[model samples]
Target: MSLDKRKQAFINLGHFLNQFNSNGIVKKENVLHNDLFFDAFKMQIKRAEEYNSWFTQNNVLFALESWTNALHHQNIYEWLKDYTIAKDSSKTIAIIMAGNIPLVGFHDFLCVAITGNKVLAKLSSNDKYFIPLIAKYLEYIEPSFKGKFMFTEEKLQDFDGVIATGSNNTARYFDYYFGKHPHIIRQSRNAVAVLDGTETHEQLEALSDDIFRYYGLGCRSISKIFVPEDYDFDKLFKAVYKHKDILKYTKYVNNYDYNKAVYLMSLFDMKENGFLMIKEDTSYASPIATLFYESYTDLEILKEKLNNDSDKIQCISTELNIADSVKLGQTQAPKLWNYADNVDTVKFLLEL
Candidate 1:
């Protein structure tokens, strides 16, 4: 199949996703296969919520909307414009997806399919519904995709390469097992924000989205902050008050209560505003309902520290003129070319 056919199939899928939202589901007359897929996709969304409590309807729609905006013809063309994809030789690429957030590994899946490779996906148990349903939609749009995609619960085999997302521990296992194949194995990494106490209230409020979205589960979510010394907490706390509604989620509230109790029992120095807690720590990964922060004496020294620990970091959010830093509120909404772990997935797939 031609790469143009594959790209058009995904653009059709994007149009299908654009019809559903939290307010209501509206079927557009122009969307392809609406008569067959409109109702089925709605049911799949409900099933996804039932399968995992973390996959709430809002979050699921958010993921869909993000992809809907991304899969336009122009966007897809621009993303692949720099790469030369070889469609003559077909290979199978196995993907081990991580389900910390909805569709966390969909980017890898898209790369594999777009680059003319068969996808052997092992879906995370927490996220079994959405991707497979989308795969079916793609098959309907372009029948050639019918046999190119496979989802399995058994051990993966008969693949030329692998892309796996897991913790630091599982990366060791992936390295040992998939060592001989061309692969990209991603480990845990967390995002951080840099604050110089010069940020506007609006900027800080937008930063709250980076912290609270997906309940801070995804690697792109901001889990830590770097602030200048003697920074006051009053403005930051007041700004994040906009997201106090997040506490209404039962699981998030439970985590807040439990972590707050533990911190109090241990007498840790921290600050809280009932919904979110900020603690001073040197760690990058923070628990649910909590954020870790560290004070930096010198901006240059802190830059050096972050550079030295780049592998442990995903993307940095800052208003300062820092190299490769994402805007304050744009960390979670990554562009098509914002490769994870600073690794080029399209280049990897082309080489395979």
Candidate 2:
């Protein structure tokens, strides 16, 4: 298919996804194939939640909603405007998806598809169903998209290029296996927030969403924070209390209870407010329901520290107007151009 045809198909798919949200799944008039798909899509959302506890309806809808906002004609054009995306000869691109959060791997798929490459995806067992259904939806919307993407349970073979997302360990394995092929293999990364004690209660509360959304499974979720030496934890605790209802999820509560017990037995110094925990830690990757924190003596020194550890960081959220700082609550709601790992997937795909 031509680039315009492929782009139009995704824009239409965005219109379809706009129907579902956290408020409620309301089918609207003039949506494509609502008679056949609206109910089916709703059922798939339920099925996604049933298959993965982290795939809560709220989280699934949020992912869909993010895509809906991104898939508009203007947004797509803006994202692709700089790129010279020619519908060249199709190459099969293999994707090893990670299922930590709902639809986490869709951007890679979208990049490959939009650039006119065929997809051979080895989906995470934890997240197996939805993308294939999306492929079907794309096929129906643009007949040319048919046969452009396919999923497989069997061992991947005969693909021209590879794009894998996994833990650092799995990434090592991917590097060994796909070393000969042109590839984009990724490792786990975490986001951190720097606090200066000047943030409003409103900003701090908004920061809670950056920390707790998707049960802290997404790479974009804030797992660590940098606070000044004299910063108070009470303000953060109070702000995060807005999400205290997260205690209702058994999976999260179990993780919270187990991690808390281990920390207590180990005599780790930490603060908790029933639902979330904040510990003085030097590390970036914290346990679920727990956030690691460190004290910064000066913004200049902290900036250097952040620069040194940039490889381990994703988006940094703060209100200090720091370099590359994402807003308090906008990390998970990334724009189309905000490539993960700071690597441009579109440029990578186009080069292949």
Candidate 3:
């Protein structure tokens, strides 16, 4: 199939996703294949939380909304214009996706589809449902996509390259198994924010979205923050207080109760606003419901420190001059070109 054909398939999928939003899932008139897919997708969105307690309806809607925005005609064209593909390149690329968030692996799938390469995906059990349905939808839209991608539960085989996302522990096994093939193996990395005690309440509130969205399961979620010595915790607490409703989710509250008890038992100093907690620590990846914080005396020195530890960091949220820094609220809503872990999947596929 032509690249334009596949692009149109995804554009149609975007229009399908556009119908389901937080406001309401109002079926649109122009979305292709809606007669068959519209109701099924709406049911999937509503049932996501049942399959995975973390996949609340709101989170699923957010993911759909984000993808709806990303798969626009102009956005897809702009993102692909800079790359040159072999046109005839059709290697089967193996994708091992992490299930930390809804459709977390779709970006890799998009890169493979856009590059005209076949995708052999090993779906994460936590996120298995939506992608297959999406694949079926695409096949109906562009029949050529039918056999270009396949999902499997057994071991992966007959693939030219691999892209795997997992924790640091699983990455070791990925290296052991897929070491010979060209691969992009991603490990657990958390985002962090830098605070200079001058950020407006609006910025801090935006930062809260980065921290709390998706229940802080994504690698791009802000798990830690770097603040000046005299930074007021009250400011952050007040800003993020808007998301206290997250405590209504039983899983999150259970984690909150458990992690807080452990912290108190260990004699660690921390503060909480009944929903979220901030603790002074140097670690980049914090537990659920807790945001680790560190105080720095010198901004440049801290920047240097974080830079030296780049592999453990995903994206920094700040107004400061830090490398790979994103705006306070923009971490989760990354552009399609904002490659994960700074690895360009499209470039990898083109070379393969």
Candidate 4:
């Protein structure tokens, strides 16, 4: 489809969503505030609340806005202007989505749809309904897409390019099996926070949202804490303690117990409340029962180390960009123009 046609379809999808909201087909939750363009997203969040707290309470507005904008900004014909796909319409591609957080699969959906390929999508059992709604809308807009997009529990092979998402362990299986095929494989990842100890208690408290949000399930959640040496643990705990009610969730308590047990066996000293755990470590990622706290002296030096280890680090959140501060907790979720995985997606698509 042409860019103008695709944009029109996107607007139509947005209108369809608003129309759904108008007819009361979806329920309203705290996160489901009536955004004019992203009403379907509110419905998706309300549905997700039945399973996950992070999706229920925080309302990841970005997830909704990003999908609509990604579609609107997409230029299907332009993205395919350079690359070549098999001229055969029968060619199919397999897509395996992640249930880690809301709508992480949308990126791959946009990729295949805009490329005009037959999509053999295996929806994550965790996210069974939401994307199918979008797909249904797309079929409504372009009837030819009906046979082109499908959902299945079956494995797929003999395709053009395969895109699969899973944990670091499963990625190896994807690699060994689909390695020779053209593909983009995404593996497990986590984000981190760098604290200079100069931040106000209020900012630190808000930062807690970035940490415990979604129960630290999103790749963007802060699982690690890096700080200046001599950082005050009392103050740090005080800042996070403001969100003490997060402990009320039974699942989080179970995760806390499981992780604390593992730590005890590993001989790591730690303290935990009902939901949150604090421990000392140099790593950037931590388990649900614990948060890794590391001390540093120089922001520049820390930035250098982060730069050296950029492959392992997803984002670096700090109050100020001291020297090489890479803003943390703001990874993966890109701005309207920010491309997926920090690659210029528009350029990639255009050059396809």
Candidate 5:
């Protein structure tokens, strides 16, 4: 299939997704394949929530909107213009997906299809439905996509390259098994925010979205923050208070209660409003409903430390002009070109 046909299929998928919003589902007239997919997709979204308690309706809608925003003609063109994509390769690329957030591995699937390579995907059990539904949608739109994609629950085999996302422990296993093949083995990485005392309330509220969205499961979620030595938690707490409804989710509430009790028992100094907790710690990966914070004395020193530990960081959210930092609140809304772990996935496929 031509790249334009592949791109158009995704754009059509985006249009189908555009109808869903936080308020409610509203089907639009003349959407391609709506008669076939609209109601089925809604049922799948419901199934997603039942399958994983963390996959709430609002979060699923947010993920759909993010993809809708990304799958535009201009965005697709801009992302691929820099790459010299191979047009005639039958290379099969195996992808082992992570189900931390909804459709988290869609980018890799899209990249392989767009680069004229076949994708052999082993779907994570936690996210077994959504992507396959999308693959069916694409196949319906562009029939040529039928042979270009395959999903497996069994072990992956017969692929030229591999892209695997998992925790640090699984990365070691990935290296041992797929070491000889060209591969992109991703390990756990957490995002962080650097706060100056001068940030407006609006920016801090946006930061709260970064911290709380997806129940803090995504790697791009802000699990930690760096603030000035004498920084006051008053403003931060006030801004984040708007998202207190997250506490209503039973899994998050359970985590918050359990972690809070453990912290208190350990006699750690921590601050909590009703829903969220912030503790002073050195770790980047915080537990659910809890955010780790650290105080820095020198901006230059902090910058050097973050830069040195780049591999451990997925993204840095800040209003300050730090190198390679994402703006506050835009961490989850990554552009099509924002490759995970700062690894150029399209480039990897093209070379393969």
Candidate 6:
């Protein structure tokens, strides 16, 4: 496709999306309704059970809206002008998908798909079916892209640019293997929060979504809490405890048990329940189904520390007065433009 044609293709896709009424699909797909995009969210929630928890019907709506808005904001069609791979149709991009969360590899997939590069995707064991089904929907939108994407189990080599998502430990292996090659490696990360006394009972209850949503498996979930020294922890606990129904997820409870026992064995004085934990620390993010608390005196110092610790942090959700340089989240659900894992995806792929 010509550059103009490619740009128009995206623009046309956006327009089509606006007109794309999926009410029937939403009902057929069994997407439960919520306040956010009542129709679209239902479709996405239906898609959630197929793979990574993050890519569900609920988030897909949010993802598409956010991703689409971001594209418009960044003028991605123009940014992609120079990166279009027309003559190099044979160039293949290898994507090692992460099953830790839903569609964690999706933005990278979009990079390849929208840029017209062939994608050789390696499915995570946990999310083997999610992407393909969504891709099937794409086939209806762009029939030409059908053969351009592939799901694979074999090891990848000789790909132009690799995008791999994995743990901090596995990142070392990816670095040694594909690091020298042109690639973007997303290592493990966790998000945290800096809380002031300004939070209300309602805000605190909503904050529970930030912690327990997806059973605390997502990278965006708050793993730790930072508070003022004189702040009352009881109020925070009381607020979060109101949403105790979230603890019913069997898998979440299992993780809480595993972590709580480990804490007890190590002599850590902490409170635990079926789905959440309260640990004391100067940390921003914690492990699954766990939360760490720390006292901060100065917001500026905490901001510096958070910026310094950006690699370990995915996002900082707070009522604190944070600079615009840092990303902010009020509750659990992220806004459309909030990039995952704090990575500059367009820049990363454009460089590739």
- Count backbone overlaps in model 3: 0
CA lDDT of each prediction against the hidden true structure = 0.91, 0.91, 0.91, 0.65, 0.91, 0.64
Clash pairs detected, candidate 1:
none
The Cα error of candidate 1 at residue 212, in Å, is 0.4
Q: 1 or 6: which has the higher lDDT?
A: 1
Task: Give per-residue CA lDDT, model 4, range 47-150, as digits (tens).
Answer: 67676554543444445544544444354344445555433244577888887777778767766665556778888887776788778767767565677778
- What residue runs in model 6 are displaced by over 4 Å at the alpha carbon? 2-25, 28-90, 272-274, 283-285, 324-342
lDDT of 2 by residue, 125-184 (tens): 888887888888999998888788889899889998999999999999999999899988
Better of 3 and 6 by lDDT: 3
- TM-scores for candidates 1 onward, in order: 0.98, 0.98, 0.98, 0.78, 0.98, 0.77
What is the lDDT, from 0 to 100, of the residue 261 in candidate 5?
A: 98
Candidate 4 worst ten-residue window by lDDT: 28-37
| Whole-model lDDT, model 3 | 0.91
**What are the per-residue Cα lDDT tens digits for candidate 3 across 199-307?**
9999999999999999999999999999999789999999998998897789999999999999999999999999898999988899999999999999989989998
lDDT of 5: 0.91
Clashing pairs counted in every model: 0, 0, 0, 6, 0, 9
**What is the TM-score of candidate 5?**
0.98
Regarding TM-score, does 1 or 5 come out ahead? 5
**Candidate 1 wrongly placed segments (more than 4 Å):** 22-24
Q: Distance (Å) between predicted and true CA of 309, model 2?
A: 0.8
User: Model 2: how far is 113 from its true place, Å?
Assistant: 0.3
Model 2 has an lDDT value of 0.91
